[model samples]
Target: MARRNEALLRWFRQTGWTQRELARAVTRLGQARGYNVAPDSSRVRRWLEGERPRQPVPELLAALFSERLGRPVGPEDLGLGSGAPPGGELGWDQRGLVTALQDFTRSDLMIKRRDVLGTTAALATGAVLENRLRGWLDPVRADAAPAASAGRIGTAEIAEIEAATRTFWTWDAKVGGGLYREAVVGQLKAMTDLLEHAYPEQIGRRLFRSTADLARLAGWMSHDVGLQGTAQRYFTFALHCAKRAGDQRLGVEVLSRMARQMVHVGKPREALSLVALARRGAGARIAEAEQAMLGTCEAWAWAALGDAGRVDRAVGTAQERFSRAVAGDAPSWLGYFDQAGLSGMAGLSYRTLAEGDPGLAGRAEPHIDAALRLRNRDAYARSNLFDLISLLGVRIVQGEHAEAERMVRRVLPVTGRISSTRTVDRIRPLARRARADAARSTDAARLAESLDGLLAV
Candidate 1:
């Protein structure tokens, strides 16, 4: 005989439905969903005896329980299967994806799962990339009902969330991820709570779009702080939210950001594939600025892969497209991809190219300088700092040891104020290089000592 499912038994009892009545309910639910499922009282008995229901049935049961409980539910809640895929896995079905994000965000906020939050693992295989792309391409389902709850949500609340998201975004840009990670998480929790409340369909869509933007920003901040696993989960959830909002462009944006993360983590090939997926999703009708942003991302990936020709072509395309972009033509989320953002990415791409060909420093320096000059130091401190460090690295590679040392000294004091581990990691290489060259120059020796002191913090 099969073992009983105690969790299912408890939920069934709490629901107060006879096995036959539950069967009838499942049948009606399936009919309403246009699925041919017809579980009977006997089927319910088998489930009670721990026979796992198949795909659509488990999803339907979760939905039923969620409706009755006035909260989102999942297969794992009923002890039906191993817990849904971790939130970082972006290829799950709509309901499973939403439920996974809810659990992951809660766990991240509580700091209960350090291992999950701290990992830097990459899981962007071709199959996974294709799966996510297919999901993004799918039309939004029309049958999803507005969430049910005792309280009503309005557009004003959504406006507040949007304003808050913008505030956190600006803070992250200026103060770095370490300063705003907790605040972003708190905002996400509030948005998730709002999602649980009843609202009109139009308001619900707006809420989801805003939430998607916030989730993407949270992922970016997480990446900035070197919490790659946490970042991946946030990006996946942002994609889910964009899909729910029927915003393909936002989904494409999330994919681009994920591609950027992949490149940073040394998975350039995977990054290239992800960028391709984003382009495919955007198709021919995307705005020029969005096209330019995607092109720059592609250039970054190609530069990482050491494809100089492709990088040049891609960067040129990005620049040409950006020149055609008018103010307010792109979406609000794409606002960051203006001239300075493009210059920063171009500088990064050139820096990557210079790694294999030191003579390329001449080509890279102007872009890096332009990025620094174009960015507002107060509003975009972290990015400006990063560009400065990149330029320092390029100078060091060009054998301008004394100049590089002075630049490092000038920036050393600011690093203490910024909380990003990534910034420190980027600076460490220059310190090591300076140390290695100390025997050749007294300035190098002194700079190395100062850098060591800076790194000690």
Candidate 2:
């Protein structure tokens, strides 16, 4: 006999669904949404016996229950296990989101439960995406707590937080994310505590916006080190804070970041949807530089979709918008979308397309070269290494083995200094390709051996 799941049993009885019927309904729901879930009656029986289904099943169950109940339901409501921190649920109220963020930040800072917190599995599901979008579009409300009557918070404190966030951003750009993650988490923990206390309405809104900025930075840093699950949580928290601050622009930026993450995780179709949501959220008031950034992200999604025509049009639009952008006209967060950044995105789009159509190899090379030349070596070391790797791949495809070998040699030492798995992922494929063609050229063989030696450690 197994332990009883009272919560699940209650919901099951209320819905009047037999175990087999419920399993069939879940199967139909998943298949209708492009998932291959095929939970049988036995699986549903296990759930009633307190055996939590993996991942997506929990989310799928929640969505099913929510629809049947005519209200939002979550894994917690069904007593299902979740990878999210305490209070982490889709369709949470604003206070719930804040509480979840605080708990998550504390755990992250203490480095407890990292294994559960750092998983990327089940993150890109349709149900999760729809829930998050609905939450973002909902109206902002003031916290239930009254304003502080004694201790007061003001702009100076917010400025200091902003300045620190910028410093962390610079460190992330110069060094890899692993180096500064702890410090950012510490700052965020402190900020979360501050937000919990009372302050004037104006001060409270500014603090929320500032906190959102920090959260977004932390998410980006987590992404740099390839902690996609952790990054997604932070991005979600930032979206909540942005909404609480009544800053639609910041919310749009967070959505764009999430979209980029989706692209990196091989969900380009979902990524395109996120980009569209970000654009819609921005409405007609988006700044030129911000538009450029969104356009580049859109191009990346299109390239991933293998739509060469849409990729070309999107990249062109990005370049044009970026050209029209003037300094100080865009938001501070848009600082990273400079000429070098745009070139890198363009290079990435062309390189992805070139993988299928080698004729685009020539087009990719110049943009990649511009990114390498224009990027500041000290600040963008990791980015530059990725660019070099992309360039090497393009050269190999073009049969310029000598240049490819030279590029590998240049990037190998840089790779040692970086802690990004994504960088290694790109380089490993290039090395394998070179090794496969080693019989054709001595230089290729030498490069392959070198890469193997370097990567073995």
Candidate 3:
């Protein structure tokens, strides 16, 4: 506690913030925004003394400090640290498949809630996700090795679940999340239960890998259904399962996806944190193919965080690593990361950073075009949505409404196919702009109405 308090003090002082100044800033921001807040001096004393602010108030505190200070600040900013001990949050980092599955029961409950998480809640999650990635090279060793499996889960069962998951993934990706999120979540819960009781350790690891994939899909499904808290929980649960499988490569992939979620919800700093962890995890002892996959993901995160230099470095690393990821050279576990996937990731990263760097937008398009040419439906769906977003932004800047509208019409229905929340969220702003643009022109009335209808739904 003393060490934590000292760290908090150092952070505050280094940021040029006094306890009184921070409190004053928080109160002023709150009052201006119509929130009732206590005066700065009292709040400062309480915060400095280690009292955690509760409720809607916590959001206000984070918002006020972050806005004024020009960096992301969470509850930890005020000297209130996690309720869980250091690396205690990383208990999810436990390596035994069974133990990780057991821990999901707690995480599942947290995911199902609808309330806004206070900074502490989010920070706790961020900590777990980040730690898993950062410590990938030196995963916590398990006390008991998993018992060897008798055999694979019957071929029939594996086939059944795989087919269903793939089908739902396709359906959700194309139709809207409103299509089959509940069904997928239900399937995941049931599968998790069955996998827990029936499978031995080695087979259980593979089962848990599938389980984590499904869990992440469930999280994406939740995001589609607008249950962010629930989605976050699933993502966290998926991370645990990935760790349990000793699949750090896939674990980093899941974290990258989680970072994408953060970016969608307008939390770019947290997204940066997740990506940093992914890069840290991929630094050593991972397969070359896995290294490329993680590097590409980190590139995306840096792009989202508006760090051009890091984004370029990561993209370069991703391309080089990806070149080393030949079919003969890489593990079966890494086959999903083909040339098209890497290119899609590169395009997506550039598209994200394009807003802050127009020149990069031009550079991003060729990759986006190449990715689209490959037409891996799901990967293409992601690339198209992001490309549309980037193009729409550029069009808006250049006052090219007709072109932007054309892109929107082509992309919206395409976006409708994937089970990606971030993709959907990205298109919303573009749809809004299109409608507003359409409203201004005599010929655009019908187009504006069409866009408004899409946006309304």
Candidate 4:
């Protein structure tokens, strides 16, 4: 009954793959991500005859096509669905970043998940991200504001916005951004309205910096709540505003945050690319605290790629840079990247590596423990909860299922209180692993059951 999928037929022919071949390829790709996919020739034949497969099959097919063809491919490209890819890529509008921000916020306020992103973080970026990164690496001056509007906000207004942003940021770490992201989005919309107006050049730059910071926080919160497409808009908006304000520190941080999102979603190569750009853009003048942060991001990306040596090197560099940072010397905006933060990043890096090799779980536990020991549990309740989960993961992988079972009791309650979708995202794979090992150990089965409950929110 479907239109016979001419688009899919064309790609199938171009790839020179038979129905069986495509089926096998899709199955292999799916299995790599732990999906129990077992599609055969008949399934691929049905697809060609206009039967669209389920959630991840279309994504897998698109990824396969992209790889074989050496270009970006989305389900829509094969006429299987609609748009560019699941993680939406911002086109970086030609009119201006501000215009794009305005348009994005308008749609966001309407509560529609309209953008097209990669089907999953599992899909390789292929050419799409490379092209975007090229644009990021190039120079492009922002549009100048039309002559200043008569009414203007002064330093006091800028400080207030900054203070508000700091508060929202703290909320993101303390309670997760699930409920408050809408509020942050509304605030950003207001900032965009003010940007449309004008102030003194000094006042304007400060305002833009504040807006950039607010937008970045919005991005972080959106991501916390699992709005990846919406989050990308805020991240790019932050970059545009930071660069427009001539704040290298803000720009580098924005890029770094973007990189973290990429790594979070399983696009490690793209994550590494963003961090490389951030490092190069920061130059030698960048502060030690920022250097440490960037190094940790770089380490995470490398760990995703399964390069333990590179992870070690990056972790070492981060530790050294963090050591060089004078107490209270980092820009106030970077206050979160303290000793606990470094240890968490390091622990997370090893955790990422160990996920692929349970033998390496030992590398992760010490740092995770150190982070838990140093962190202020009350102030960073959400972050502490995430660390606790990470520690549980280490225990499970280390075959210390009894200890991991004990941890699930502590972590499960706090996890329920925290609204972070990232906590869910982070734990899902671990839960899957536990479930897989459950047949062998009663303790692992129990751990899996407990972890599964925490995944509900």
Candidate 5:
């Protein structure tokens, strides 16, 4: 049998197309390009299962994704190209960065278009991003020079954008990304437009840093609402902005978020690679809290791999670093990862750890409870909901039928109020484990049904 064509499948799902829809869209695209080809659901299925289309079809597919992804998407990206192309999709220069940002905010890029650009995101591989960092670590003088356009902007405007980013972040944590993604994108578009003008050296760096912060927020919110590919694209460009700002810490933080995305997609080894690169790039004297955050990320990756020893060491390192954290030692960007954040991350690691070994359920509960207790009722309510589900997952694993039932009964009703894809993702596995065990009680069966209803999976 042919290989399963995971590359094509990954992009296909990222496109959020039903087999029939993809078939119809590609067929129409081919016709528009003057190729009289007929493709249906079966044809799409074959492509997904490792069958390459005849000449011109793969090219059409590439064209479709290139337009949809806002970046170059070749046949290689979809597993239909020849000659064993390197496993990455990263080739954008400084000039190309503006084009990428502009493509993201196109008015024509609506959800119901030929492909959902913002609503569904394609995954970016770790190799692709780390490759970009090669340029970031060392910058050229020409790239750093002030814009040649008629000079105008200053520090005041940069301050406003930075404040707006912080505000949006707070909103994202309180409300889900689905509610305000368009607003974030719109602001991001306006911010990108400002780059056309000129500012002095200090103001220019500040502007780029502010833009980087906003772009990362846009990416985070995109990921929040299930737009994985869009998130990656935003993050890739945010890295571009961070580099332009000459801000090493921000770049490391962006990589950390990318690592989180990897973990979410079950690519923990990739996640580990990203975190490792981030630490190595930061060098020896990273701030205490940032060090803790990075360590927690490492522990989470270790937990995903079921490496208990490594997980313990990483978490221990994180906690130790967190204790020594001094006021103002971290940058303003570090505000989000406070005591509550560290506790929640530690809990999440153990919860992921419990996935591979249910006996570790006890290890996860206390930290999650601490997170639940410490998280601000208004600012981090959405996260609190996620932690509640973490609690439920741990309970289910520990064989607490009645308690789990009570918890889900309460949570099931409230979850609909939240609108993050991460929440949906959290429910997915808990729903699976609840239904899989025949030994589970009626309460467990009902809980699974509720979760399935929420997910419709």
Candidate 6:
């Protein structure tokens, strides 16, 4: 089954464009369509070789191809569709929830691209939103699980898998998601295949749960790689798997990710609604720590929307919950949500509201600083970099160019490696603000110039 139906690659071949030509054409189309796409021909080769496109580009690709060929080209053409090759598509609906979460932990590398080389694939943000809303409204249809019993994957396997995932997560946070996403994705795909083929009923159930975790990670890695639509699809699958496994808490967590993605793309209102839905589900089975983490996330959404009161209230709740959760070991799912994590989130929220209250600058600083203190580079690093960038923006806004320069200089190395478009988006505003508050000889001027140099190529 895996051998013949390379439908996606075939479709690309039919487009009458070489990798270089396709890239050039797409770049031209982006220019015409008013998107700031710094397209490179090498990325086209990655797309042809089964890598998914990142947010903004996937849709742009579809649109560009549609315009050139006079028809619609979907993510599938780029091999990002549901029917991707063996072990490729972590069909969350087929697996159970625990597996989905397990997949989430391990799937980071599968979706990442070479961001340091500027090879991150871009998914059309609108396409992802469209897909998520469509799936939420109409729901994706899941195939019935294969009739197989569970296998002998035991505590050792579970521990090994978890450790591996944590390592990648840490690496992804520190070095860049692009560095490890593919490896994670491929591993999950293989794991899914084995479980689907030979595991027993009892084992199958547990395996499915584990697979769900990997799938979630895969989705996240996809997002990191800039393949928002693919990530959305994977996340939706992970949610379905979680539901099948009867874990409402995990399902809600997936929803939170969806909402976070929305926030990344400037849809705070939609993000807030998604977070609200997550909160409602949190009432069902989440641990105290998870609950607090959700609240902190909610605060971020509210802050993004300029709702100071709600952000404050939500942050307070999050802090209280997090404090209570500290006495015991948190669930594996909630292990990633720690004091530093929540503090970083709080920092972002406060920074967002800093425009109205100068005091927030002080409040945001400590949290951001604490987050940076953590040696564990997981998602926390990528996320906190944004807070630092946000803080730099605030400094620029306050005519503190020297401070802004120092912050940006600190942030650049971190941002350079991560395969996150959102980080780039965050940096853009700071650069613009710096340029606006120009000082010819200041460090802020140098930082802005550096940004311009990077963008020029």
What are the lDDT figures for the candidates, one per model?
A: 0.77, 0.76, 0.61, 0.77, 0.76, 0.62
Global CA lDDT computed for model 1: 0.77
- Candidate 4 weakest lDDT stretch, 10 residues: 115-124
Residue pairs with backbone atoms closer than 3 Å in model 1 (clashes): none
Model 4 over residues 1-457: C-alpha lDDT tens digits? 8657766887789789989999899889899988888899998888888776886787778778766754344555566543322133433332245544554565466433333222243232647655544455456555556335654678887788888888888888889888688888889988887877756678877878888998999888877777675576577778767766777788888888888988988788888888888877667757888999999999999999999999999999999999898876667888888899999999999998998998888999899999999998887998898789888888888888889888888887798778777888888888999899999999889988887887764
- Better model by TM-score: candidate 5 vs candidate 6: 5
Q: What is the C-alpha lDDT profile of model 2 across 276-299, one tens digit per residue?
A: 877777687788999999998999
TM accuracy, model 6: 0.67
Per-residue lDDT, model 6, residue 444, is 63
**Ten residues in sequence with the least summed lDDT for candidate 6:** 110-119
The CA lDDT at 10 in model 3 is 45
Off by over 4 Å in 6: 1-144, 148-159, 355-362, 373-384, 413-420, 439-447, 453-457
Tell me the spans in candidate 1 whose CA falls farther than 4 Å from its real position.
1-94, 112-118, 122-126, 439-443
lDDT score at residue 291, model 4, on the 0-100 scale? 92
lDDT of 3 by residue, 158-198 (tens): 66787777777667545546567667766776766655354
Q: What residue pairs clash in candidate 2, if any at all?
A: none
Better of 2 and 5 by lDDT: 2
lDDT of 1 by residue, 1-457 (tens): 7678776776677668899988998999899989999999999999988787887787677666655543333455566643443222333454554555555555456443233333464343567556645667667765533345644667786788889889888888888888888788778877776676556668877888998998998899888877775687688789888888878799889999999988887888888887787778768767899989999899989988888899899999999999998887788878777788999999889888877788877777888889988988888888888898889889877888778778877788778888787787777777888898899988788878877877887
Candidates in descending lDDT order: 4, 1, 2, 5, 6, 3
My TM-score estimates for the predictions, one after another, are 0.78, 0.78, 0.64, 0.77, 0.79, 0.67
Return the lDDT, model 5, position 436: 84
As a TM-score, model 1 comes out at 0.78
Residue pairs clashing, model 3:
111-230, 173-417, 173-418, 173-419, 174-416, 174-417, 174-418
Off by over 4 Å in 5: 1-93, 107-121, 144-147, 438-440
